[model samples]
Target: MSVPGAMIRCMDLTRFFADVDAQPWADLHHAYGSAADIPDCLRALAGESEEAASEAISELYGSILHQGSVYGATARAVPYLARLAGAGYRTEDLLVLLGGIAEGGADEGDSEEAACRAAVVGQLPLILAKADAEDPGLRRAAAWAAAMTGAAEQVLPVLRLRRKTETDPGVRAELLGAMAHLDPPGTAADATAAIGAHEPAEVRIVALLACVDGGLPWGPAHHAAMLSLLPVNDLVEGRLDLERNEPLQYVVEELLRRDTDADRDAAYTLLDGALRSADSEARAEALWAAETACLLSRSAPERLAGAVEAMVADPADAPAAYSLLAKLGVRAAAAAPVLARLAAGEGDPADRALEALVAVAPDRAAPLLARDLGRRPRALGAACGFLFGGAAGASFTYDPELLDAIRTRLAEAGGPGADEVVRLVNLLGAWGSRASAALPELSAVLSLCPGAVPKALVAICPPEHRGTTAELLTAAARTGPEEGRLAAAAAVRELTGETGPLRAAVAARLTPGGPAVREAASLAAGLGPEAVALVPALRSALSDRAGDRNIPQMDADVEIAAALWRITGDPEEAVPVLAGVLAEVQPMWLRWTFGRAARAAARIGGAARPLVPALEGLLTEPMQIPSAVLALHAIAPETLDGPRTAGLLLDAAEQDADAETALDALVVLGPDSLTEDGRRRLIALAERDLRVRASGLEPGIAPADERLREQAREAARTPAKP
Candidate 1:
């Protein structure tokens, strides 16, 4: 456990971490406050003693790098650990632990992460040599680590040789799964041999999953064969006792959908048995599989609906059935009649059923909900479910009669059920156009429910009624309930579209100790250029509220920065804060910052150049890439280079996932942006109509016309024309 031994072998460790004897413990962090104690754990892991090493690996596995997220001290710890693995460090899960660290820090786009992998790669020769260790365990561990570090080409040859002579079924199966990644010509054949191997059930399960993942999960016979071999220990992470929990038909239903050409007759035979089974687990899985996998036999929907209809008598089973039906949304329209009965039931069950009815068949359930709202204990929520609470629920607009019904109830149902009236009034505010006739009643609630009046009034009042709305909201912003005051201020700003009165209102609540700081900032953001008057207040609020999460729908810090930029028209004012957020070492959890920061950075131009390294690292993720790509070209257009950026723009355009940002990047990148290689691939992709701007409205696929040709024409307008 002496420091000199590890230091002598891996001298580069001193760059990021302290030595054991002189550890500056107070300054480091390892996802658990102050990592000063980490050096002892590292030393114990380095020692030759097995018991000490076991305890060390267990304690430090997640701490050094928590679930693939790296901390400051994580990179420093990698070299010493790699040295231990290279020098024959022993433990059953040591290779698994090391493999996590290697891949956890595998983000090569960032310098700190690149350094960790670089250190591991330097020790590859030593790690690879361990595959021939006298102990079979060490050899297995070494092979696992090599594959994780992408020494696949190097590791697979050694693994193949070991598989030929290895007697341990567990080790041989592990070798086959590892080899599946590189997928040389005959991986499917090798996987089949492993599946047919006389090994532990867990080992064979590993081989089946590897075969599927290796893109060779062939025909229906293999699909049924894999199902027959289900309930394996490794497949479910040793959590469920699959032998007792798994029913035969449930197994076949799960694996049926995963295969492209699974036998329909065999699948239906198992599913029919599952539907008839007494086991709820089997029956439910079969129903869900039929829906998700597009495996509707002629009788599937009727059998499923009839089963749900029968279950409506049992309150306990009905809600869950309704919830499962809701998973398919409008596709489960066949279950509407049954769902409506449950929606008319009592309490939580009714709420869930109402939600499911909206999802399953909004149009059919609409009149039922409209009539029931006046009588239910929570009428407002039922209305929300039909309005926009469930996915696709918004498309089911209220009938004018429904609006009149809600309006009449809002006024008549005032006194003891004022909260109900309040909720109805709030709905009227949000459904402005649909419920515009409900405004006179919303204004009437001003005296009835003063707390909910201001926002509702501002949000729903006719434009001619602005004078009355401004008066009500101004008073609410000054002295109403804390929740209503902020809502009032926001409504006032949005209603007036003039910042003077809204600014005065928000300013009254923008004090350091005030509860409306976040709302005030939001109002400031919406004010645009008019918010310049509140800069000092925003800056002060941001300082005191650095970690504040009170503001929903946006990150508080990012909003404050964005507000500052909009108000000042000075990129210098906001760029620093946006850059700081963009440059976070672990920005994965702070994804809310990506789009906000990217939009701000794209406006700031050269001010964002220094954060280029941080921005580039986000390219690995699909969700964050569009914004990151925008920030990249905004700061340094030259970094985008050739076809990859061009192709990404085309792909994002076709997908419409983040086409606006991609289109913006193309603009910053200028004309003739793609290199010849990118242009070639792009044209081919568009030829498949993958980059069509408008899907043909008339009928057949869109021809490679002007709109399609433009994608390959202007860099910004360039369709990825194939």
Candidate 2:
């Protein structure tokens, strides 16, 4: 009869009473018959007289509890009897029955419940005796049962049997699988000893698979077994089959898919080998898997430090190495000396290493680059370029003393690094707000290197230097060759305002023949009222043929759009212009330009309202999601209500879902709504789904849905664990 879940104790008692009138003697006893069928005949009686049925069942269970203590059959059934007795029966009676079962009579061994209890309390002697019983069935049951009871003492017996006549392959495999459930300290050593005692390849494979499944710390024995398994053969295939059994496959797959510290660290050294397999899809899968592991490990300081160490040791992986260093950020301070050493080298890898170093320890790295200021100018130029390159520049800031030191270095006698010095000058103009004292020195350098100065002056020279810089830039653009005039025009176009000096400078650069003249005129047209005089010139450039570097249409678009917005006080003019160019735009700069235009429209009232729905749709794209969410957050944070967002989150948390995107969305949505009941449900979901999704992830990086399982564990604890 099926027990109703409403109250197991009450139902069991009721079943026993209903069967009292004509209790079947259990005459049809198979080796292991179901204990359930006996109560069937009393089903009608049980419904009519519930109290009478309960009493009869209780009495039967009590008698069974008594029988279980003194007979072999009862010993096998004692755990169930004990459970029945404990449901509503007296606690003292249950304890007494348990004691009697443990102190078995001459014929019967300890009851299974008593043996399991003994295992739980570290009484290994009792379990060892049962495991060495004359009957193989009893030995197997005891060994396996004790394993489930979390006893470590049976590990040795399991190993010893493998060494003896382990003739039955299935029996031997079962024993190895059982060993995987044990977590004792010396289990690996015991498995290794068994492997050594048996010279057969099957035995060795079983031993190695046992060690892997054990998931213990890697000791000498584990190392030996792994090395032996490295060479693939029939034996290796067999061993891998054992390791990839349903349970282990699930565990390894779950571990490989998450971004957890343990998952990342464990797989770091294995991924490269997986990638180099002669399989293209395998290489892609392995690369992505390892990348997932690294992302998960980013928050772990120790793992991040380890990754930095690996990068230093292997400079050949410069791109991957640099990206890892960037992820480490300031936490990788320990890698500073290594970065300094690498920056001192001349190889291209050395340049990459320096960039990675600067990314992590920018303040410290600036000094190293500064100390080697007089080294190879090409390397120096590359270093300075990386320091301020659009890609790596935002990753760091110049410490005050470091910028000062660079300024002082620029004042020193010149060399092949002069181009780099000019680059630094441009950086100061762009970001050197605190380097006011260096302006005189910058002006001196510009004057001394007139040709070099104007090339970068628009980006470097401040307004105080603008008038003088403009004079120099204008004179150079008019008097020098095509390149010099382009540099001058580019410099003068950076300063905004419709002042007399700016107008004169733009006029001088717009002599109307070269690309330099057209670019200057286009920029002048966009510089608001300052560029109103260049309307005719800008229109003329739009019709002119393109050159290698000039963008006549784009330049004219930006200029005309800027001038129209300033003159008419309308932001819509810029939106349509950008919208027209959207299809042909590259991702690298498109969104940034669009964002700027949108922000400008926002400032000029609701000119950007029409684009809100378009921006909202971008939230589902992986790369664009963050920006879209941020924009929405700014516009309407309250729209992400608990019920709606939590439902979205739950959908993402499903096993078939995209885990990385789910995690990202969860981080944005927040977990405020994951209440106690919700957590319990999540745990139940994880338990149901873990078997399927476990194979796709790394071991340590389990799904967030599993948090419910962790909560269930916490709830069931009595005193509560720390």
Candidate 3:
């Protein structure tokens, strides 16, 4: 076992572990608790068998560099790993592991991450020597490892030297990528130079990306270089471990990073050509890039929708095409004709086609959906208009045919699965009293699917049927499963304002260790003063912090606080809990918990004055603006800078970053707070054909945009009082 091109003598295997026993392994930690087992994993890497060494490296990755996270033990293991590679003990695998550790880097001011990088840097000599190894695989691995060191000064020169003689296009691509990573500006000209016709397709693909990464001007050469390499999958053959495996998608991402209209146009151009390509592979790659492009560029949905429609024309490609169209929402209305034709047919493809149709043109989709009910579960789920638990948009238009289909599906003996039952019932619930015809079917399923049926019954039953509905709900609440019982109690309360059933059910589920504590807290909040008797149970559950709860602890606390406020109207009990959540939650928590806490605090009115600073702090965050504004308006309207708040909301609206929330906030502020320019902007937003809420890659963008536009129009029409 000797190194082929070793510049430094490889240390003995025994000596590699000379100091291993001296380290306080038990005191150190990796991703999963103590580092005591790390010594065995390190020694296993030095084993003679490849299978054992492979497993050992994988185990080490899971522990030390778990999911790109580095730990104290990660730095300690670097020296032994370097020695193993230097000694030619699974050098390729060890180099890859070392590279991953280097790339994971460290958090700011984390000595361990810095130490891990420094440790890799310390072994630069042995690692760089392998860049010239005879095995192209080893050399490729070495290039990647060397680049990960971030010692551009040392690694770049060696990589450039290797580039002069490297024959493998895969290795050369890795080298170009490494150099680009080390210094994008310095490597831009080199990257551009490699895009010539003479370079292998693999090298040119990477060089083209380097130019994009370096912010080199997009011109004829770069454009031609990219177009010529359409469907780069064949040339690269998945050999190069590029960040994004698909070259076209990688290019779109890099182009979008520039985030200019010109860059977007450039991406659209590439996708358009590929979409029109006779080559199926090229079109397939374009489809992936199109989804990414549509989500990112405001102009993309219009530009790519036609090309995507063209892709949808192929039966083999229709499923994926329908998925992207669904995500584009109403932006893909132009494809409705094609979707309807396919949806008119049979089987999974038609079902998928109908699902997209429902998303983009629910009216067009409704008749087709009604015709195909009971068979197309996914399309029906789309028609239900709720994703997970949040309302995505308005449900499909009420149609006699569709209503009849739902009733038929519900009435069949041993009918749809629990999920389908839930979806059908939800659609009925969305229709309210118009779906009164389904009441018998809803009542029949109460015993079987009580969680969904009770709520739907509450919505569909008219005034005359309320007594019977409440009686049915009361019986279910008393006898059904925990989930069903809770839902029944809630419906009963909603119908008759009856506190007994709800209180009894809520009290049973409000125990500290109960599975439905969050649900119970929510129902308790809805009860308001009617739920006063449950205040003690709610308080106890607030501090429960049960580890197995479905919702986050902070979320449960916010719910309990809101419940306490509604039940007892005690600001002291609620304000501090809401404030603490606002103060302690991280930025990632802003999506739900922070907004929820702010809205909860808003309910306390002036009594929530203590939470004003916390709510104000959230004003700076784009996503939190709506909840914060609404809260501040309720709690302390006098302290707000109306013009500044208006400006922030307007900016968010124009950018579509948090447009819906911003628009809602503006509506609440009314026309009086708006400047003349703000009013003009609002009118422009309402009249604009392009969406105001088109930023996310989710499925409901089109409907959400329309909803925003309608709201904007309403806000603009609100007269300013003299």
Best by TM-score: 3
Best by lDDT: 3
Error of 2 at 34 (Å): 75
* Stretches of model 3 off by over 4 angstroms after superposition: 1-11, 106-108, 234-242, 328-341, 344-346, 360-368, 386-393, 496-500, 544-554, 576-595, 608-697, 700-722
User: Candidate 2 at 431: error in angstroms?
Assistant: 6.6
Give the whole-model CA lDDT for all candidates, comma-separated: 0.59, 0.46, 0.80
lDDT of 1: 0.59
The TM-score, computed over Cα atoms with residue i paired to residue i, of candidate 3 is 0.85
Q: For each candidate, how many residue pairs have backbone atoms clashing (under 3 Å)?
A: 7, 23, 0
TM-scores of the models, in the order given: 0.60, 0.40, 0.85
Ranking by lDDT: 3, 1, 2
lDDT winner between 1 and 3, please give it.
3
**TM-score between candidate 1 and the true structure:** 0.60
Q: Is candidate 1 or candidate 2 better by lDDT?
A: 1
